[model samples]
Target: MTAVEYEENESKLMRKAKENPFVPAGILGCFAIVAYRLMKMKNRGDTKMSVHLIHMRVAAQGFVVGAMTLGVVYSMYKEYVLQPAAAQKALEQKTALEK
Candidate 1:
């Protein structure tokens, strides 16, 4: 095979081989946005003295809390887990190449 064809195939293999766990994390974030919009729409008629106002406030607070928790967890997982693992992999590759 030509050099260009070999490089192209190698890249395609790499692309398919890498499993990005962050894609689901991003989808979770998008889901939160959708949920927030839906909640707002559901409580659009809530007024200062309406019983629905309290429920709306509670729902919004819950959403905020949940979103914050998810963000913290995702960030901690990426920082404490994913990054180190990737760095170790790179180090191993470098060592192997130097051998």
Candidate 2:
């Protein structure tokens, strides 16, 4: 590909990376709420061991969801916020040197 094409592709990637952090946080937030609710239900003693077992399954599902959500949020924060801030600092230093 030409230089211009490469640059354009790179810029698109950077923009996507910058905008990607919210999805995981939103997912984690949802799971946390769900797990909390399930735990509450478990505490109510409205079900037998089998019922509690089902609640445990529900809790496990929530845990998996929360973990996956965390992974996404972390990826987004690192790619968009942290990496950009670091890159900006490096770019500023480079510009200072050029001047």
Candidate 3:
């Protein structure tokens, strides 16, 4: 493609990306895929498993599990705890305004 056409297309892609709600999740998934591939390559055989490799894998697994757990907890808090509180506050404000 010509330079101008490429630039126009790139700009359109950027604008679309800016509006995409899943961009963060997509980026995180890409990073996780790359990290998993790299870890596999690093641990490829011929060299017997060492203490360091085991520790590294354990740490990585812990990090992934911890992050997932945190995300679930935060989402639950927002949905069950925060939403009800917010709704109650809004209702109180509406009632006060009507008084």
Candidate 4:
């Protein structure tokens, strides 16, 4: 992508990450744990690297699922809880005005 478009996309991603910081935090936590485990290993080789690759894939998938789950939950809360409360407040204010 062009540099300008890339920067816009990056900013959007940063905005979302700031909104729901947990997903990024979880991803960082997962990678840190895996890195620690790998460092602790005395024997490292092709086989070990392959196994760690699988672990990394699992961590990536976990991040995706966690992010999706958090997004869904946040959407539901905003729709069901916040919207209704806002509507209720507006209705109350309208009623007060009429009275």
Task: Give a tens-digit lDDT track for model 4, residues 1-99.
Answer: 422233444676576565566667667767776776567555555557668768766876677678678777886887799989999999999999999
Total clashing pairs in model 1: 0
lDDT tens digits by residue: candidate 3, 10-87: 665465344442444444655675577556766565755575466556655665566556666766887799989999
Off by over 4 Å in 3: 1-51
Across 1-99, the per-residue lDDT of candidate 1 in tens digits comes to 422233444664344223333444444555666577556665566454455556555655666566557666876988799999999999999999999
- Which one is best on TM-score? 4
Q: Residue 97 lDDT in model 2?
A: 100
lDDT of 2 by residue, 1-98 (tens): 42223345466545543455444454566667666766677476656767765766676567666666776877788779998999999999999999
Q: Residue 19 lDDT in model 4?
A: 57
- Assess each prediction's global lDDT (C-alpha) against the native: 0.61, 0.66, 0.62, 0.71
Model 3 local distance difference test score: 0.62
Assess the local accuracy of residue 59 in candidate 3 as a C-alpha lDDT between 0 and 100: 59
How well does model 4 score by local distance difference test? 0.71
**lDDT head-to-head 2 vs 4, winner:** 4
Q: List the residue pairs that clash in candidate 4.
A: none
* Model 1 weakest 10-residue run by lDDT: 13-22
TM-score of 3: 0.49
Which segments of candidate 2 are over 4 A away from where they belong? 1-46
